[model samples]
Target: MNWRMTRYTYWMVLAVLSFGPEAAGATWHVDDSNTSAPWTGADWDNPFQYLQDALDAATAGDTIKVAQGTYHPDDATQNHTEGDRSETFLMQSGVVIQGGYIGYDNESPPPDTRDWELY
Candidate 1:
């Protein structure tokens, strides 16, 4: 009922609306089951066991280390598009997904393949 309180509330709403989708970080990682067959973990070494899970948990700028696989929607990925490449992982706002091999699923991992980096 107070005008002062209404003014404050209006400012708060304005603040949140000022920033667009690029305001905060929001990244999605698809490293677990690339094609829904299960992470090869060949080059990954220590596979996370849940690619979609990781992606779901990731926010902006988080990089999902996709080793090698086909992450289809059947595996819980509903945001995939035709632009998505087989090897290239989806990068979102500030997201920096990395991969060992993009095409060659059987390619050997790097000697010091630690993991993908995020923003």
Candidate 2:
């Protein structure tokens, strides 16, 4: 309504647009190691490499497209520890992961300890 309020709203809008979908911080990409032009490249073209990279750089609302490979955590722990857990792959507050999502149990090598969550 007022010029001040309008200006604040404008700035807020700009911020949201620039940073993106609020908690949008997920990264998507294949995690295979065999889809490169040279083939000799170090997973350069392999979706797996890119996928892993994205996961590493993801924040929130991001989605990682895992091709077809084993996704094992470093610790193999059964805990999300949301909020600020490094290896948790929280996918932020509003992130989504695509591809290779075999659910909580399918994620691991069966007999899962119940660690991942699929929203």
Candidate 3:
């Protein structure tokens, strides 16, 4: 392999090994169905109503699990104009945001199932 490619691979492996589950932080949840739910985002049943809420609460090494739903950028922020395209979801380094979850099925205990092909 080329020198640059070898070095890149080495660094990638090292990074993965160095930052393992020990570096992992909390896992936040966001479900659109939980509009009136608490802002905790602690679990599937009590998830943040908006994706923006999870983003705001997340720190480095944190993971945000989002349920299947249509989320608009303008829905969270009221300061910006209704149709303003400038408003966007700013991502953070080391913070993983994942979607495709079937959250809170109204069972005794909510279920957190992730199947992207469910649609």
Best by TM-score: 3
Each candidate's number of clashing pairs is 11, 12, 0
User: For residues 1-119, could you state the per-residue lDDT of candidate 1 as single tens digits?
Assistant: 69999999999999998875754444333344334444433334434444544555566656556644555433433454444445344334655556653322334444234333411
- Give the 10-residue window scoring lowest on summed lDDT in candidate 3: 74-83
**Span of 10 residues, lowest total lDDT, candidate 2:** 37-46
Between candidates 2 and 3, the one scoring higher on TM-score is 3
RMSD of each: 10.2, 11.9, 8.8
RMSD score of candidate 1 (Å): 10.2
Report residue 89 deviation for candidate 3 (angstroms).
0.4
Which pairs clash (backbone N, Cα, C closer than 3 Å) in model 3?
Answer: none
TM-score of 3: 0.70
Q: Which order, best to worst by TM-score? A: 3, 2, 1
For residues 63-96, could you state the per-residue lDDT of candidate 2 as single tens digits? 6545544554432223433233355343345546
lDDT of model 2 at position 31: 43
TM-score of 2: 0.35
Error of 3 at 18 (Å): 10
Q: Report lDDT per candidate.
A: 0.48, 0.44, 0.77
